[model samples]
Target: MQNDLMGLDSVLSQISDVRQSVTDMNAISIAPNPLSNGAVGQVSFTDIISNAIRNVDSQGQEASQKMTAVDTGQSDDLVGAMIASQKASLSFTAMVQVRNSVMMAYDDVMKMPV
Candidate 1:
């Protein structure tokens, strides 16, 4: 089981690397995202943050539903439930880390001699 998980992790890492490469190769624009509400230029910070918050919320909600199913004997897939739980935990942790970084940056900027 451990070996399988390790193999899965490696595959995921490789996939992410490939995705990054593809993104880099395709990133040819000084203009805002044309796909984003037909905007003429780059996506705004607010849009990025709102999307991230929505993603976190969706992950938590999904994990909660899976947990409820397992608890009520509605689902027999223990592994799936565990995976969902872990994903939710990781997402929340990442969200917290980002929040902390943002707060620290804000503090540093405020402390700058103006």
Candidate 2:
């Protein structure tokens, strides 16, 4: 029973770690100097979205690795794996929600009063 609990703790810790890592990735951004506007490609919404998608993709891959580790029994912390899995699931859901909202917004814009 103690071992199981420890495993759970480890899984939870891993989940937290993954969440933190993903947050860190998303927090990164690049800003263009507004003072000098002589560029072929200036900062745009698409660039930000592309970076965000890449970060999310990497986080998903890391979560998959954690799950695989747990399934292989190579990781002695089942609890940590469980937590990580749950966190990953939640993040994925949130991303889906964001995508849905963006699409809806785009559609609304397309139907705006001209």
Largest lDDT belongs to which candidate?
A: 1
TM-score of each: 0.64, 0.56
For each candidate in the order shown, give its overall lDDT on alpha carbons.
0.86, 0.79
Model 1: per-residue Cα lDDT over 46-89, one tens digit each = 77889999998998899889989999999998888889889989
lDDT of 1 at 26: 39
Runs in model 2 lying further than 4 Å from the true structure: 1-42
Per the 3 Å backbone cut-off, how many clashing residue pairs does candidate 1 have? 2
- Superposed by TM-score, candidate 1 places the C-alpha of residue 6 at a distance from the truth, in angstroms, of 69
Question: Clashing residue pairs in candidate 2, if any?
Answer: 7-79, 8-79, 10-80, 11-79, 11-80, 11-81, 12-80
In model 2, what lDDT does residue 1 have?
A: 100
Per-residue lDDT, model 2, residue 59, is 73
Give the CA lDDT, 0 to 100, for residue 79 in model 1. Answer: 88
Against the correct fold, how does model 1 do in TM-score? 0.64
